[model samples]
Target: MVKELDEKIGALPDHVGWRLWRASRAWQAEFSAAMRAAGHAWFSEARAGLLGHIPRNGTRQSALIERSATSKQAVQQLLDGLEAEGVLERFPDPRDGRGKLVRYTRKGLDALRDGDRIKLEIERDYIDRIGRERFAALMDALRSLDAGPADASEEASVPE
Candidate 1:
């Protein structure tokens, strides 16, 4: 059985990383196409992720790095683009003299709403293709993978 499992693994065309990359790219393409069809040319996966992380109340630019799980430079670049597109604005933090708080403008809020709608459409499409039960199971599996051992040094819990 172990040798059969090894053979199966070896026969796979791509490893986990490659599969994940392909999946992410495919999802991003669908998301981008949906946004374009909705007349939102500027909408992108990065922007959507960033928008999801920012609270309605707003968030500090420095805080976004951790929240977005990205570098400060990358966050700054995204913020600059969003600002240029009139989606968001950065202003000095009231409590912190040097810190900047990023708040969604009216346009930003509208775009965020549109993104949410697009996301729902995409989810529904997936459910339709895979069925509700399969979709739910897929999401649960993904969540479990995400919740794997917190420390990299520790072994992940694999289900039998």
Candidate 2:
């Protein structure tokens, strides 16, 4: 069944969006596998998205919802799971008494370090396979396509 779907999709017209989606999917799988190998067996591509939006000092729950481009309920569910796993904690927002701020636990910070290191390693692998010049061109082209990434930048989340 999967092979049949693959054949059908493969027969369809190829375009930039299709290629990008396929590439992203492949990369995500590789990243998840790498995380598991690095002793973070609970890590996954979805959790990575949640983790990426968290800053060192922490951000409000509403801010996480906005930055992650996800529903408030969805963000809460993710937060609840992470909290259960001891990866993060939620605190009452001082500025807004009714609001909540989410911050990483010690475990999460350690995982972030591993994530950053793994990301760099992945980039080096891509450079070796595609050549540095070609990889640089690819990055430039990708950046040109979008206005810019979301206000997802917190600090040290993305590799230099």
Candidate 3:
């Protein structure tokens, strides 16, 4: 699959492939800046949203950290800021009083919802520019790439 993708990429026009790669980073910066300007900055929006999905008061902070793919310290920092902003609250885990559980406040849920709406709007605009067929193909290709086996693991396991 990697070889096939490499061949396809190799066949792309130099300018097109280069611009596609460059545009991804450029778009990320633009989107992050827009989110910040809209008072939804920080990578924790997705993390907070995921936390919201879990049963409140029953979910543990460690679970949230794992699902968010962020370090415990980083999650704690984001949680602290969110708590200060009244977006979420931390409580002692009933299962283990020493452990903490995080839950989103009404404000936090609202913020997450608003940020998602904005992201959808931005994506819609980009898709509109790309046109439906092209956008569909691009999305399908990206999803296929994402679903493929871990290339890094395969490479590491190969005989030297």
Among the numbered candidates, top TM-score falls to 2
Please state the error at residue 124 of candidate 2 in Å: 0.9
Candidate 1 least-lDDT 10 residues: 151-160
lDDT of 3 at 34: 68
TM-score computed on alpha carbons, candidate 1: 0.76
- Any residue pairs clashing in model 2, and if so which? none
Each prediction's total of clashing residue pairs, residues at least 3 apart in sequence or on different chains, is 0, 0, 0
Model 2 ranges off by over 4 Å:
1-10, 148-160
Error (Å) of candidate 1 at residue 145 is 1.4
Deviating ranges (above 4 Å) for candidate 3: 1-24, 39-58, 150-160
The full ranking of all candidates by lDDT, starting with the best, is 2, 1, 3
Q: Write the per-residue lDDT of candidate 3 for residues 1-160, one digit (tens) a residue.
A: 9998997777755685687679776666666666678786544444444554456343688887777777778778777877787878889988898988877788766666776777688779878899888988987876655555655454344211
Per-prediction TM-score to the true structure, in the order listed: 0.76, 0.82, 0.63
Candidate 1 at residue 5, lDDT?
A: 91
Per-model root-mean-square deviation over C-alphas = 7.3, 5.6, 10.0
